[model samples]
Target chain A: MMRAFFRVAWIVVKKDLTIEVRSLEILSTTIFFAVTVVLMFSFGLVVDGRPLNDVAAAILWVAIAFSGTLALGRTFERERHNDTLRALLLAPADRPALYVGKLAGILLLLALVELVLVPLVGLLFAAPIFVHGFHLVALLAGGTIGFTAVGTLFAAMLVRARSRDVLLPIMLYPMTVPVMIAGVRGTAALFQPTPDLAVAQFWIGLLGFFDVVFVTLALWTFDPVMTD
Target chain B: MHSDFETLAVIDVARHYGRRKALSHVNFTCAAGDIIGLLGPNGAGKSTLLNILATLLAASRGRVEYGGRTAEQAGADIRGRIGMLGHDLFLYPELTARENLVFFAQLYGLSGAHARVQAALDRAGLGDRADDFMSGFSRGMRQRVALERALLHAPRLLLLDEPFTGLDQASTKALVDRLRECQQAGCIVVLATHDLDIVDGVLSRAVFLQNGRQVGEPGPGTALRERYRQAMTT
Candidate 1:
């Protein structure tokens, strides 16, 4: 049973990856959007010769959150265009397996965006985020998991709604407050001149806990929420 | 191959959206080898009935039983055995015809899925275009691919709604031939369409619905168009 579940999930992942690889639509748009936002932030915030590093953590999280949402929307939007989500729902595989598969795909796209955004932010803002690279990676994983867990659930729920474009962020942002806070604080701690591993670990731990809670919730609720 | 005990019993099924009723007290029984045409005009609840049978939407007031088990009782196992092709193509336009079939076949847990996907592509007469992206296909090609996807699992019960929307004459004839093959294999087919000519010679029975009610059951002897026109007017 578990093997079948994974097999189905792998198929879904492969399908999404194949489309993404061919078009590069979601990845390119998301990365471009993130970099543009980061650029806007850099130019908008100039405080008396203060380095951008002071607020770089917040800036990075904002870029990720917004761009992640964009990626989630585009990812599910593809399904909506051809009613492929309906086809997916008709499949007899476990619905949670479907959710996990989509979550993995969205995570991969968001990771790519972050990979580019992190380096770009380092170069433009001179944040030195890579110096504490391990801590940064940990924070990114936790925050991303939490964000996409709930983001994926909502995105699926809203896929068929006529107002999905406006509804997605409206419904998503409020639910993800804890994730964003932990991400910003954890990243901020890592960015400090004298990095505080303890603070960073605590926030990362909180983000991890949130991810566990929401992923479980998402898996449990996906079937009911998606089915009529 | 189809199930020996193929039957679908929709008993007193009804669906409502707040104060508006989409379907009410709908009742029907379909068995294997039956090609049932669901004829209705606009707002006559044909799509809603098909959706209910597809398990995409739950009937608010009654139950649908497959092989003596309710959908809730049979669960995903039953769902796995039912194939559906609605008005939407239910395909990823970015994927090639072969890729789309393979993906759905895998989702259905078909063993030797790659070979089965190839077989389906061949059966759909899309072997030559299998590698081309669906985004560039004509409407008839997309319909053929959608039909192939639905048949990939060899489902015992097939539900199709407005499947002839975009097909040309040759594609439509190809679809009729495939559906005839399905019926011969003892697969129950419930086709919903407004055009009576499409299923005229193929349909084993016709059920006419109006305002969420099954107003008439026109058998093979009766001209379905006459029945449909009468049902809608009165």
Candidate 2:
């Protein structure tokens, strides 16, 4: 059973990657959107010679949140249009395995987007992102896992709903408040002058706790929510 | 362990959508090698029945059984032995035919996936076109690929909803021939289709449905189109 679960998760990730690599639909669009959001923020948030205090972290997290929402919706939208989710659901694999696999794929896609967006944010806002690099990475990982874990569940749940485009953010943003708050607060700590590593670590730890709880809830709920 | 089921039994199965009943008290039994045809009109619940059998949608009442065990009792692994091709073909358009089949084959954990995928590709009859993305294929070609995709796992119960839709004559003939091949392999093939004439000679048994209820007793014989016409009219 464990073998089947991992096998299914790995194959789903492979399938997602192959399709994404060929089309460049999700990765390219997501990165473009993230960068655009950051640029938009740079316009509003930057002052005489620098971004306002603590605004850099807020802008970065906001860009990640908004663009990550788009990425999650678009990812499942591909499956929805083709009704391929039905095929996946009809597979012999476990439902939670499918959820975990999709979450992994979305995380990878967002990680790539952030690779560009984070540096761009640092360059524009002068946020010193690489100063507390390892803590920042840990924080981002914890926050993203929490965010996409819930996002994956909701995106999949809404795949069959009419007006899913309208519903995704409405359903997503609320359920992911903990993720968003932790991500922003942790990154704020990291971005502050003379970074508060302890505070950032605390928020990162809180994000990790949320990740565990959110993933467990998602895996537990995925099978029933996906079923008609 | 999942493939050993010889019979798929629908026992008093019914599915409802709010107040609308899509299928009601439907019953049938299909043993391995039997080609069961579900013939019906536009709103007659043919797809609903097929979906129920595929276990994609649960019946609101009663149950579906593979061999002697119900779907819930048999567990999800029972789905490993069930394959379906429906109105939605479930193929990723960006992927090549080989890629799609290989994906499904690997998901099924089929040993020798390369050979299996090649065989499926040949069955799809794409030949030189197999390497191209399916987004470029015509509807008939896509249908063929989807059929092969569904069959790649060598499922014990092959459920098809409107399997003949959008096929040219040659492709339709090819599809019927493949159904025979599945029957020969001792697989239970259930077809829900409006092409009663096309499936007339191939069906091991025919069940006519109207407004979610069976109209007549199912039997295997000639002149199925005429029989279906009378069943629906009456």
Candidate 3:
């Protein structure tokens, strides 16, 4: 069963990746949106001449969170369109495998977007992002996993609803606030000259706990939702 | 085990949709090589019955036993032994024909996914199209791909809901031929189709359903048409 789960997970992830590669809509759109958010924030903050550290984390998290939500919504909407969601449901594999596969795919995309946005945000805001490279990267990794876990599950649910396109962001933003909060705070603390491992560890620990709880719940709920 | 080899026994299966009854006190049995055609006007619970057997939906009451094990006790294990083709094609249009089959074989935990995929395509008469992208294929080709997917795992039981839809004459002939191959392999094939073309040769027995009740198990000759006529009038 474990083997089947991972095998199915890999297949689903490949399918999603292939779709993105073919269309290029998700990759290009998310990058453009994230960059725009960064640029808009930079413009607003430039006139005041405030230090970059004050709002750098907030700008990064908000931009990444909304862009991530858009990408997640598109992933599921694509599945529901051709009844590929039903195809996955019909596969003779464990349901958690589906969840893990989708979660991994979303995280992969999120990681790619963040990879570019991180450096750009630093250059635009004149902040010391590279100085806290390892710690900040770890914080982003932890928060992205947690965010995608909930986002993928909710994306599956919203795809079947009547107002799926509109309802997704409204539903996603509230659930994602905690991860964003922990992520922004951790990143902000890491930018300090004396980086606080304690703050970073706290948020990472919280992110881990969130992953465990939601992943378990998502597994249990997926069977019922996928069937219907 | 051989004593119950050909039996699909159901013990008082019932289903409910909230406060409404979808299926009520249904009981039936089918033997190996028997292709029973389910018939009803609409909302006669045909889908509900097929859904339970396909393991896609659950019954609110009673149990289903196939080859002597309760379906609930052997859900995952039973799924391995059953092939299902529903209204959904369940294929990735972006992927090649071979890729889709390989993926499903992996899901079924088959180690030699490559050989199984080849065998399935060969049987479906799609070996030449194996490398072709699926999006360009016609509906008949898609249906054939779905049929091959159902048989890739070598399921002991095949459950098809409205399998005859969207097939041209040649493809339909190919489908009937493949179904015969399945029966020859000793797999119990259950077809939920409205097409009465197979009333004589394919199925040994047919169950006539009307308003969630089994009126009778008609024999191979002249029974399906007679039963369908009897069902509609009454």
Candidate 4:
């Protein structure tokens, strides 16, 4: 049973990746949005050609949150476009396994976006991202998991909804408040002059806890929410 | 992936959308090797009934059973035996015929997927077009491929909603032949369609539905389409 769950999850991941790699729709759009948001922030905040304190961290997390939302919506929209999700749900695969596969795909997509996003933030705001890169990765991984875990669930719940496009961000932003706060604080701590590792670690730990609780909740509820 | 299920029992199944009833106390049973037709008008809840049987939608009241087991009791395993070819066809336009079949085959964890997909492609007369993107395929071709995709697991219970919505004569004939093959294999086939003409030789018995309720079977010597029209009007 366990083996079947993992196998189904992996197959879904492969199918999603195959489609994404072919179209590059979500990847290109998400990257462009993130880059543009950071650039817009750079122009508005860096008024005197000197960066505002800790704004790079704030901007990076915001770009991720914003771009991540777009990616999630687009990913499920593709499923709804063809009603392939119905076929998938009709399959014998475990519901949580399907959720895991979708969550993984979104994570991989956002992670690619971040590869461009982090360096852009560092360059634009002179944040020391490279200096504490490892700790920063931990923070990003934790925060992203929390956000996408809840996101995959809600996006699925809304796949059949008439107003999914308008409702995604509205429903998502409020639920992800804790993730955003912890992510911003953790990365902001890393960009500081002394690099407060202890504080960053604490926030990362909190994000980790949030991921665990929400992932469990998402896995538990995905079947019920998706079954119409 | 031949299922051990011998019967699909739908008991007192009623479905409601808000205050409107889509199906009410609908009851039927299909045994293995039975090619049952669910005939009805546009608002007759044919598709709704098919969706419920496929486990894609829960009935507002009552339940569906596979081999005397409720879906809840059987869990996800019941789905393994249920194959559905819905209105959408469920084929990704971006993927090729081969890719689409292989993906679904893998999901079912079916071994020898390559051989099975090749056979399915050949069966659909799509062997040469296996690698070609489905975006370029015609509606008839896509329907054929989608039919094959749904049967990749050799599901014991096949629920098809308007499996012949749009098709050429050749495709329609091919689909009827395929349905017969499934019946020979002891697969319980339930189809909901408005193609009353094509179902002449295909349906062993048909259950007419109107306004979400099952109308009585045709009186002896009443033509199927005549019975269908009577069911719709009276």
The alpha-carbon lDDT assigned to residue A53 of candidate 1 equals 58
True-vs-predicted CA distance for residue B28, candidate 4, Å: 1.0
Q: Would you list the C-alpha lDDT of every candidate in the order shown?
A: 0.88, 0.88, 0.78, 0.91
* Poorest stretch of ten by lDDT in candidate 2 chain A: A44-53
TM-score of 4: 0.97
Give the residue spans of candidate 3 off by over 4 A: A1-5, A40-54, A157-159, A166-171, A191-197, A224-228, B1-6, B197-201, B208-223
Models sorted by lDDT, best on top: 4, 2, 1, 3
What's the CA error at residue A207 for candidate 1, in Å? 0.5
Worst 10 residues of 4 chain B by lDDT: B1-10
Candidate 1 wrongly placed segments (more than 4 Å): A47-49, B1-4, B218-220
Evaluated with DockQ, which candidate comes out highest?
1
Q: Which digits, one per residue and each the tens of the lDDT, describe model 3 over residues A1-228?
A: 577678789977987898778778788889899999999989987655554555887888988888988889888877776566765665667877988898888898889999889998778766678776777888898788877888898899877688987887787778878888889888878766677878877887887787778778888898787654
Cα lDDT tens digits, model 3, B1-234, are 222345687678888889888777778787777666676656777777887876767788887788767755665556777778876777877788998888778777788999989988887778999998889899999999998988887777788877888788888888888888888887787777778765346765565566766665543346567757765665
Which DockQ-derived CAPRI band holds candidate 1?
high
lDDT of 4 by residue, B82-111 (tens): 899988989888889999999999887789
lDDT of 4 by residue, A1-228 (tens): 889888889999999999999999999999999999999999999977778888999999999999999999999998998789999998888988999999999999999999999999988898888898899999999999999999889899899899998999899999999999999999999999899999999999999999999999999888987878
TM-score of 3: 0.87
Q: Write the per-residue lDDT of candidate 2 for residues B1-234, one digit (tens) a residue.
A: 744599989999999999999989888888999999988888899988888888888889989889999877888888889999978899999888888888888887889998988888877777678789989988889999999888888899998988788889998999999999999999999988888789878988988899999888535454887788788888
* Tens digit of per-residue lDDT, candidate 2, span A1-228: 899898999999999999999889988888898899889889888988688888888888888888889999999988987789989988878989999889999999999998998999999999888788999899889988888999999999899889888998898889888888888888999898888888998998899899999999999999977777
What does candidate 1's lDDT look like per residue over A1-228, in tens digits?
999888878888999999999999999999999999998888887455455555888889999999999999999999999889989999989989999999999999999999999987776676777778998999999999999999999999999899998999999999999999999999888888888899999998998899999999999999988878
The lDDT leader among the candidates is 4
DockQ-superior candidate, 3 or 4: 4
